[model samples]
Target: MSTPMGRNVIALEWLQFGLGRLVAAAAEEGLTIHLLTGERSEYAHELAELDSPHLVVHDVNTHDVAKVITTIRAIGDVAGLLNTTDTWSLVSLEVRAQLGLAGPDPACIRLVRNKALLRRRLYEHGLSRADGSPLADTDDAADVAARVGLPLIVKDSAGTGSEHVWLARTPDELTAALDEARRVALRGHLIAEPYFLGPLYSVETLTWEGRTRVLGVSSRILSAPPVFREEALAFPVALPPAVAADAEQWIEQVLKCVEYTEGFAHTEFILTDDGFEVVEINPRLGGGLVGEEISQTLDINLYATFLDLVLRRRPALMDAPLTPSRGAAHARLYAPRTGIFVGCQGQELLSGHPGGPVLRPALPAGTAVRTIAHQDGCVAVLFATGATSELALQNVLSAAGEIHVRMEGDDRG
Candidate 1:
């Protein structure tokens, strides 16, 4: 078990927002990036501004899948197995079939990480119009609102960043979201569906074998829901060249309904008024500063397609030559309740705003903002740039409305 010489890889733990662009796209090509991590301080601002020697920071325990497959089987002869992270993509699909490497098909990443069997398998292949009801401890809420009706949506079926998800709408808000989902604290289980409204978008593909390419369209400024947070994001959302080629042929039939061939997905849908529906398919990539706002507004690096899908090959983002210079966007800084975060204030006037809005910081000062109803109260973020995407979302919402986030809730962390 000792073969490492040059291109060694294995990043089973990542995505506290693209660890410094995955260590500068694993230092060009002569890769390295070990990082097995079980919380290297959830990447302290990408390991405090990485100076990368092709990264390598392993602590392990990564939620103990047999102690992360007995520590990447003593790291040897590596060159495949990287996960942008949906809570570790089934631990890199059980460490790539217990170390044969090359991924996909751990039963298609457990049917795309089981959103109650991907909404009843895309409502039995009709590509979903709704059908996900799993919440049984003797089911209630009028049997999931007589099969997911009145503005439903009680998520978690293997949730992530939009944390637990809830959004009821009535029946006393689905019995107060099932009494706050029987004392909320779940990473996956409760289900229910049907909340297809509008305005939300993600699709930033990259596939190889099953061939996908869209790599654009972001626009998702949520927050005014039964609670899902997610406040700002903007990117190539212009759509209308025949509606961006029919949203890239409906996300290539929703990544061929989850066969999702090679690397990178980030799906999320909901164009509504009768069209693109899907709203949960993050096999990874669109979480905060979305892959660094699409590699700084599409100049494109996209972690060099996760170093050619952990080095199996063929992924220069599927025939490059794409372009789109400026226009990026990001925005978060949730603090209107639950507190102790103590920081941020006009961020030194964000480099005299415009597009220099930087900020970042997600939870650090005394950290203890328990629940602003998910995404752990997103303590900070700003990121801007413009010339499109509605002027980079109005320059990150005018530099996140001139900063100001200093929590306290009677202090105590």
Candidate 2:
């Protein structure tokens, strides 16, 4: 692996707050970062802190594809390319391939992009524990549901962040789930699988070549099942060593099957009585600074490592010592109910809490927010780190209790 003289890497279509932190971190490492988003305002302020000499911005939505390509070309030489969003993940692969730059293979990224393709590929490689199939339409979807039996899980074929997922317990529930699946299919296709019930767990890791190393594991707590809405994540998973070992083995097999060559992967799984079943695989850093927080706890710069992988350089990762902190937990805060922008009370109380690890006071006083469907609004996110995963969970829950959300309109529910 060759090392570049300077840090002039590019990040594609940065939008999320995580990307901002990553940009800041990269700049701190003396890396000049470039970004492309639908608009300049989306991430300009975030990039301002870096004051990088090679910051490039392109309007992804309005810019011509050829122009975007030219824009990426104009960024001079890039040591590495990072993408925060899945769409950009694909684009980054293309750009890397065009430049003969190193990153995950674009073809492999395709399999990861579509859940149906991922399941089929994994099954072909004998990496799947549960029998799963892709739903082409309402009929095939229903048939798959019937075969998988009731109490099955239906989700988008290429979905993210638990967009359109659900659990169907009976024929009627299955119909509703199928309908929802079809609706989501209108946006894209759907992937229907047996609802594997077990302690929900996720493996966050960085893979180089074919060697997939387990960075950390988290026993995930979800508000609902099959749908898999992420509620909380507790790291340094409290699982028997053998159980975690098996899960790691499954992850390795899946990565090999999908040909995941570089960078970070957030894989969700279930520890069933028989074995672990893979829920899904995302070929990027996990959301909400999961990699950062976990890296902090373990004293590894996962973000930097990811950059190294993309840059076709060997980070001194093998020699790097892991200092595992006591397990920690991360919880998300959503509005109590759905409504227009009113505001939040007890903001100071929540931030000034004595015994909590608040990553940031994200939600301002009057940020207009809406729920995923108007049932509940995601007003704020609180990540609490503690000595133990259990203690961390308790502190986040307690802090969530401390904050008060103010909303307008009558009770819709």
Candidate 3:
């Protein structure tokens, strides 16, 4: 089917941060954006405040796939469907397939949603060295530990944001991790793999009209183990020429193996002594302002580029080769412990500093706080840019140090 021209596009589960940008992009291109989301989304009021004729919000239980499809069909003439959040990718694929819109094959998308399946496909293609196996709920923890060995990572098969991911260094820890995994597994299944010891990185890519291109790479700073939370990220980080080439090659091969021929992908992996150990590939841009950082440093609107791909129009960024003009970094701030939220201080100090970071606070004053165990618990994100990677990273760090969150009922000083 040919792509629809300047028609309505349906976005599954619209929220402020990323989906807002996409909606604005669509509106700018003369396309109407219909945002479908659950009734309870916190950003519902914010979406209403857009007050644009090109944007509309529809409330439905996003988890109810059948009801969602019915609502979309009732609305009629949805030209395309898009989803940046992991929870909505499959739903978007199903909706697009049903609406005869442009998107990757649902089967191909399954390879990304299912972690164990992805790892198996990579191993079959000789693209990864990590060993992983599907775990069962009834399996004995000790026996499973003996089989997979100690110092393993356990996580849900379809989890997102590293939630429910646990690192276990002993049999007892394995049991505890398994219990936690069982609580959060959407499909009641989990996977166990040897814990990789190396620096973690993510490669962002964009595919259009059967061709894929590497957009950029970001180095990750993960919080210490037990639970993995990404604390900071720096993009356009320099890599050895040979290593960069090989990593890009590996990403392309993996895309082929999964038959992912369209859309954006954020592929995470660990740089080991031998080569890249495949982390799960996400079928969207990196979370936490990575796309915004990319747009600022590379001078391209990724959200607009994504719309181009969906409409089957060639993206202009692809026409001319582009590179990062400046280094960019993002750092997230979390509460030190569970308490009653008060406010943050030292914003004035960083506000006038050269290369100061752009701060985005997630919570308001008086909200209850909790000990941050995962990325979802972050309260604010800070983004900064500089002439070089080291300088950008330094700016973000210095800015983070100047800011401090005060909470009631917490005494960690």
> Which candidate number has the best lDDT?
1
Residue lDDT tens for model 2, 1-413: 57765466766765344555455557666776667667664443344554555355556652344555676677776676667566466666666667666667778888888887777777677676556666666464458656667677777776777777778877778777777666544334766777777877778877776677777787777775444556677777666788767777778877888888766788887778877778888887676547646765776655666556655776556346655686666666665555454655565776556336563333444555655431124445667777777777777777767666666653356
Where model 1 places Cα greater than 4 Å from the true spot, the runs are: 1-14, 17-21, 28-44, 47-49, 52-121, 124-160, 167-170, 173-207, 211-254, 258-262, 265-279, 283-305, 309-337, 342-362, 366-372, 377-413
Q: What local distance difference test score does each model get? A: 0.79, 0.66, 0.78
Better of 1 and 2 by lDDT: 1
Ranking 2 against 3 by lDDT, winner: 3
Lowest lDDT sum, 10 consecutive residues, model 1, at 1-10
lDDT accuracy of residue 98 in candidate 1: 71
At residue 43, candidate 2 shows an lDDT of 46
RMSD to native, candidate 2: 3.5
Question: What's the true lDDT of residue 15 in model 3?
Answer: 31
Off by over 4 Å in 3: 14-16, 39-51, 183-188, 364-371, 408-413
User: Quick one: best TM-score, which candidate?
Assistant: 3
Model 1 clash pairs are none
Worst 10-residue lDDT window, candidate 3:
40-49
Candidate 2 clashes between residue pairs 3 or more apart in a chain or in different chains: none
Ranking by lDDT: 1, 3, 2
lDDT of 1 by residue, 72-155 (tens): 777666777778778878867776777677776577677878888887878788887778788876777887888878879887
